[model samples]
Target: MGASGSARPAPFLRIAQLLRDRVTSGMWSVGDQLPSRAALSAEFGVGDNVVRRAQEALIEEGLLEGRAGSGTFVRAPRERRVLRRTVSGTTSPAPAGFTGTWEARSIAKVPAGPETAFRLGIGDDGMCVLTTYEFFTDSRPVLLATSWEPMAVTGGSAVVLPEGGPLAGAGVITRMRHLGIAITRVVEVPRPIRLNRDQAHLLGLATGAQATFIERTHYADGRAVETADWVVPSELWDITYTIAAPPPGT
Candidate 1:
């Protein structure tokens, strides 16, 4: 309840739900043009901004699309591919049946930013090796990644450069193992994000398009060894997780 002592939904959300019901109830079919904001505002006795905000929310959900010089229309649902992954298992670059190719550039002696410093448990003045990656399938970009490792951990070592020398293209566990670091576990946090120009351009998506951003960190006995950020367009993929079962007879 608000200060007025009555519970009420936000104006935009209320309007959005009404519009969604219309579509689902057969009042508006796929490819049908949506009512103008002016019409909706007059019908709801609300301002035009309220109606527009509601429409924009549906557009982000892939339910409504705006055509240039034309009105808004209902959009068909996207056909998505499933990306299944296990929490505690060997990491693969992509899901099965998708043999994608990637281009990566590793730069050494880079300074760690605030977020990287926090993740790697290092000071603000810590130096790092930063690697950027772009993965493609069917000649179209689908994934973007950037990884950071503290230089203090791999400096002057054969495994310093992530994609160079022997054991090149090998994952973090193998490389860290060569350095006598036992990578115990990996942690990942997935969140929603709006793609910037650089990311959207490579993926052929519009600026500010929605995507899944995953921040991953590899740990060795509670010490963070590597951190990376990965992105996948929301319209083209859905992530599925498989949880490991506990031991029997605990």
Candidate 2:
């Protein structure tokens, strides 16, 4: 169904809907390669903008993924990430197999700057401990993470953990959980960020590299517990999501 009596909805929405139907009906299965933009535009009778909009919407929904030189394709299904909101602030454990070896750079109790204050909802007087780690996957640097925790919660514990430890094993969320804080939800936001010199060295890229900036906030008992910023190179990884329709007839 579409707006009003129009069988052909808005071009991009129609494309999205049609693609969704095909995926739901199993016409396009996981890992199936999609036609090129030109082919899709010809088939849908739309311009590149419409097709681009359609592709971007599906990408945001985690259905289809686009590669630089490679065409769009159905992403392999992954575990459903149910967004849970709870009082005991906790974060989902790090994705398994993301750890190979890590280099611990520095851990210090630092002042919470403007960005940190806004993300953690801390006051000007509040201080946060910053922990920086260079995480490698398959013996290559994948992400450079800097975690910020309120001094009241993790001030002492922050400097205790060793550098380059297993992300899941030495993850802060797990540590917070043990301290009686249960993370009920995690908020993940990704954006394009300019990489600095230090970030470049950690990720094996040159200075001024473009990277995906990931910011995550962990919550427990309706309050933010921890926040982290991850700098990941554009060429190193792909993000996938699965979108599905309601099961058969309600």
What is the C-alpha local distance difference test score of each model? 0.81, 0.66
The most accurate candidate by TM-score is: 1
**How many clashes (backbone atoms < 3 Å, residues ≥3 apart in a chain or on different chains) does model 2 have?**
11
What TM-score, over all chains together, does every model reach?
0.67, 0.54
Predicted structure with the largest lDDT when compared to the true one: 1
Screening candidate 1 with a backbone cut-off below 3 angstroms (N, C-alpha, C), the clashing residue pairs are none
Q: Summarize candidate 2's per-residue lDDT along 121-185 as a digit string, tens digits.
A: 88755777666777655555566877777887765553234243333335666777667777777
Supply every candidate's count of residue pairs whose N, Cα or C atoms clash at under 3 angstroms.
0, 11
What is the RMSD, in Å, between candidate 2 and the native fold over all Cα? 12.5
Q: What does the lDDT come to for candidate 2?
A: 0.66
**Model 2: per-residue Cα lDDT at residue 134:** 71
- RMSD values, in order shown: 7.0, 12.5
